[model samples]
Target: MTHPLVKRYNLAPHPEGGFYRQVFRSENETSSYIHGETRPALTHIYFLLLKGKVSRFHRVLHDEVWNHYEGAPLQLFQLHQQQLWERRIGGQGNEYAEVVNAGNYQAAQSMGEYSLVGCTVAPGFDFADFSFIEEPAMKQWLDIAHPDLAKFI
Candidate 1:
């Protein structure tokens, strides 16, 4: 299947598996069919793919700027370091995504892994875009949300 957006911002692995290996990654850990490199122009960049319903409790470590490149709509959530104002991000399609307020939104697209293009005001990125919820709930959600995909991650 050919996607126009893919052609629009064409990027490939510098050396197949280079980035993954550098981070000691695995197809199991992150359901990444392919991982995009760190953008030079951007201070921090992480392009990842999740197989199914993903509910994370983490928020942007810093003020984040994001755009979805492919896949389905990604839900982004955040609670500022010292504020209670919550934010949510969701829209249809992957053609363009730039949410002004970052908060507690579900990156729940239909199916298939979605591409998330984002950079934080701080380099505290990488896996820094994380939120850890308690067990049982997290685990149970994984089982029901992403039956097949959950076992691997």
Candidate 2:
């Protein structure tokens, strides 16, 4: 059976993983400092990750802030400067919100049955600015440098 929250939010399978529904997109556009291109000022979406599913490592040209809403805590993993780190969102003693800076690779999964989070992107979100870590060399590097986190890829 489909998850109740997935049905309630009318989410669709995301290319990266899990399910999501875009809830807001700014009507205004501006030149993005990070991308040096004109884009929507902001965009928001509801992202849900099921226990067994994963949000594959990917990078975007804009900063994304994730806000926890319900269900289990989300284990957000980020790769920056060849370092892998994790942040838990929506659990006791964990942050309610966390940010993934532009150009940083990130992935996530639910710590329990499910995790629902609200993601807000500055300079907006466009598939054109998104990229998955599909390079064989990069995967090999991750395996060597952070074997534990390679599973996320």
Q: After superposition, how far is residue 69 of candidate 1 from its true place, in Å?
A: 1.1
Clashes of 1: 10
Write candidate 1's Cα lDDT for 57-135 as tens digits: 3443334465554455554433233232323333453335443343332232224544444433232234534444335
Residue-by-residue lDDT tens digits, candidate 2, 55-106: 9999988899999999999999998767888999998999899999998999
Off by over 4 Å in 1: 1-42, 53-55, 77-95, 99-113, 126-131, 134-153
Segments in model 2 whose C-alpha atoms lie over 4 Å from true places: none
Candidate 1 TM-score, C-alpha based? 0.37
- Candidate 1 lDDT at 104 equals 30
Cα deviation of 82, candidate 1, in Å: 14
For candidate 2, report its TM-score: 0.95
